[model samples]
Target: MIRIVSLLLVGLLLSCDEDVLPKPNSFLRLEYEKATYKSFDDKEYPFSFQYSKDAKVIEKKKYWLDIYYPNLNATLVLSYMHVKGNLMFLLKDAEKLTFKHMIKADDIQAVPYENTQSKVYGKIFEVYGNAATQIQFHATDSVSNFMTGALYFYAKPNYDSIMPAVHYLKKDIVRLMETIEWKKEEYF
Candidate 1:
């Protein structure tokens, strides 16, 4: 009788354990589309780009802007900064600056890798950590946009859990980079 009771208790515990385990979160299917808007800095400045309608643009000021891409009802933030100099120069500067900051902060483990580079345009650097993964890219076009800009994407702590959404958003960001057009004028 004790052996049968023990077996029944084990079965009950196994069933309870399954119930306690968290369910996998569902992800939304992103519908991407082309988007554009004038420069928030100056109405006369004609800054435009293609992005998803699901994404919302938040222009904090003349120099700073953020594109929030929502996933599973959560906001994934991609920030853009307009800087002086050519795309290559800006990227080199950013690498140096990021390295310096990481060293100073004692975050040596946060060192980034050049994930990829564009012989035709720019490069992307990806930094991973226990808390988040940051992907930065730079690009410029002589025939299209004149300004050098940086794109930053910050994902959640455990990237594996959000891999699907992260991948989708990364693709969206790439499209945005391709369509970026800076207005004529040195805001600096």
Candidate 2:
């Protein structure tokens, strides 16, 4: 009887050592660098606004620029085109650009933004899921200057992984929209 009891105790101990139960899923805790913004205004440029100091402004060509976030592996592309008389076409092009990610995106939500005081009116698109560009917007004076911005990450479009960075930059974009001032002289 004592031998049977010992065997039972040993079995219990072995079972405990084996750890047969599955471990719960866990995710890495990701923390991103804090952001601080500074005003961005160039006499040559038609508009002025604030942007994250963490990002570098790269001018591809005159009036065409990119806000690059190296640490976050992202870039906000700013495309400038003369409206001339094709405001509808410009608006449509911006919409098409935002929706291009629909094949990979779970959803795209447009949050309307209008700063009547600044004369910047546009729609900000928040894209969910694994899309190439997660955010985009267009600001126009509805005459000569039409500018569109799109936020794209360098890495693969894994929405879950980059959400925090996206959230942080979203605010910077909002600030940019809020502060945009179109130069009457710069307009063509």
TM-score on alpha carbons, each prediction: 0.51, 0.87
Candidate 1 C-alpha error for residue 83, in Å: 5.5
Clash pairs for candidate 2: none
Instruction: Assess candidate 1 and give its lDDT.
Output: 0.48
Model 2, C-alpha of 170: deviation from truth (Å): 0.9
Stretches of candidate 1 off by over 4 Å are 1-46, 72-89, 96-120, 127-131, 141-156, 186-188
Per-residue lDDT of model 1, residues 1-188, tens digit only? 99999999999887774445678988765653534333233353446656667767676555445666553333434343444445455556656644543432323232221212321245444444333334455554433333333333354355455545555665665665555556665533
TM-score of 2: 0.87
Q: Which residue pairs overlap in candidate 1's backbone? A: none
Query: Backbone clashes per model, in order?
Result: 0, 0
